[model samples]
Target chain A: AQSVTQPDIHITVSEGASLELRCNYSYGATPYLFWYVQSPGQGLQLLLKYFSGDTLVQGIKGFEAEFKRSQSSFNLRKPSVHWSDAAEYFCAVAADNDMRFGAGTRLTVKP
Target chain B: EAGVAQSPRYKIIEKRQSVAFWCNPISGHATLYWYQQILGQGPKLLIQFQNNGVVDDSQLPKDRFSAERLKGVDSTLKIQPAKLEDSAVYLCASSLEPSPYNEQFFGPGTRLTVL
Candidate 1:
């Protein structure tokens, strides 16, 4: 069974500071990777995804992720995070025609 | 294109009560998914349907949860004799296909509160 792991339960960062959320997957093969963001009481919005090709993939909202097959990781990064970027971030992996999600990391932006 | 649609943004029911949630996928989408998101946890896949047929439902608790997508467009999920643990947000998502190339779009979700 494929599963995702997000080590950070909650992260507080100063606004306009760089941000990096760690994500690791447990899978036998290279599975499809995805990052999603969810605001309070709102639906999830796709941040980005990695299937193959380039290891570094760019996503919406000035975010990007680098997929490292060696480590089985796809960590999301943002050079500068805004206050609006504070939300719950989830990492997911898909294999065997199925998908599984991580526990999610709660981001807090401090002014 | 419109995104996935889910109804009953909020529901409150007592133990042993029954509740149902409706979801309407985007037009032309062949794949639909239902997820259960407990507070402070990631969304868990409950079931998946491809064109009115079940593709994967291993995680769904069939003993009390039942879902159907008739005609391959809209879907409904029912939970009879609900339990407190069942209280969570039910999210509906749809994509053109199950392939990774097609991104899945999600709905606002129905928040279920079991009292």
Candidate 2:
């Protein structure tokens, strides 16, 4: 079974500051990774996905994530996060045809 | 197009009561899923349906949980004699296919509080 781990439980950053959230996956084969964001009392929205092709994938809301095979990591990054980016982020890995999610990391933006 | 739709945004019931949730997946989607998310934890897949057929339901608690998709379009998840631990957010998602690589659209989810 594939599993994902999010090292950070919560991350705080000021508006306009850069942000990075770490994600690690345990899979035997080529992993299909994804990042998703969820606001308060809402369903999760897809951020980005890495299947093949480029190591870095861009998503909506100025979010991007890099898929590194050697380190088994796919970390999400934002050059300058906005106040609206404050939400819970989840990292997921595809196992067979099922997807497993991480515990998630909550992002807090300070003014 | 409209996204996935789920009914009963919030429900509060006492333990041992029964509850049900409805979900309407996006048109033409072949895969539907039900997940349970506890506070501070990620969503866990309880059951999956592929065109009205059961695909995966290994994690579902059969004794208390039951789900069905009629006509391969809409779904309903029911919990009988709900336990206190059943209090959580139940999310419904749909994808174009049974593959996980395909993008999945999520509904707003139904929050259940078992007192």
Candidate 3:
């Protein structure tokens, strides 16, 4: 079975600071990875995805993720985060036509 | 394009009671999914539908939970004799197809509280 792991339970960052959220996956075959963000009382929104071709994928809201097959990791990065960027982030992996998601990391932006 | 739609943004019922949730997928989408999200955890898929047929439902607790996507457009999930553990947000999502590469659009979700 495919699984996704997000190590950080919560992270507090100052506004305008760089941000990186770690994600790791366990799968036997090639994995399709994705990053999603959810604000309070809102639905999950797609930030980015990686299927193949190019390890780095840019997403909406000035976010990007790099898929490193060697380490089985796909980490999301943002050069500078705004206060609005504070939300819960989820990493997902697709396998056997089903998608599995990580526990999610809650981001807090200090203004 | 319109995103997925779900009704009853909030639901509260006593334990052992029954509840149901409705979802409308985006137009022209062939794949629909239902997920349960507990507080502090990511959403976990309960069932999936592809054009009015069940694609995957291994994680669904068939003993009390039942879902149907009739006519391949709208879906409904029902929980009979609910438990306290079943209190969570039920999210509905839709995709163009039943492939791993396709992106999924989600609805606001129905927050269920079992007292």
- Name model 1 segments beyond 4 Å from true: none
Best by DockQ: 3
Two-chain complex of model 2, DockQ on C-alpha atoms against the true structure: 0.85
Q: Chain B TM per candidate, please?
A: 0.98, 0.99, 0.98
Q: What is the lDDT of residue B107 in candidate 3?
A: 98
In the predicted model 3, the residue pairs found to clash are: none
- 1 against 3, candidate with superior DockQ: 3
Instruction: Give the TM-scores of the predictions, in the order they appear.
Output: 0.98, 0.98, 0.98
TM-score of chain A of 1: 0.98
Output candidate 3 Cα RMSD. 0.8
Model 2, clash count? 0
- Which digits, one per residue and each the tens of the lDDT, describe model 3 over residues A1-111? 999999999999999999999999999977899999999988999999999999999999999999988899999999999999999999999987889999999999999
Query: What is the lDDT, from 0 to 100, of the residue B39 in candidate 1?
Result: 91
lDDT of 1: 0.95
Which residue runs of candidate 2 sit more than 4 Å off their true CA positions? none
The interface RMSD value for candidate 1 stands at: 0.8
Tens-place lDDT digits, model 2, residues B1-115: 9999999999999999999999999999999999999999999999999999999999999999999998999999999999999999999999999886789999999999999
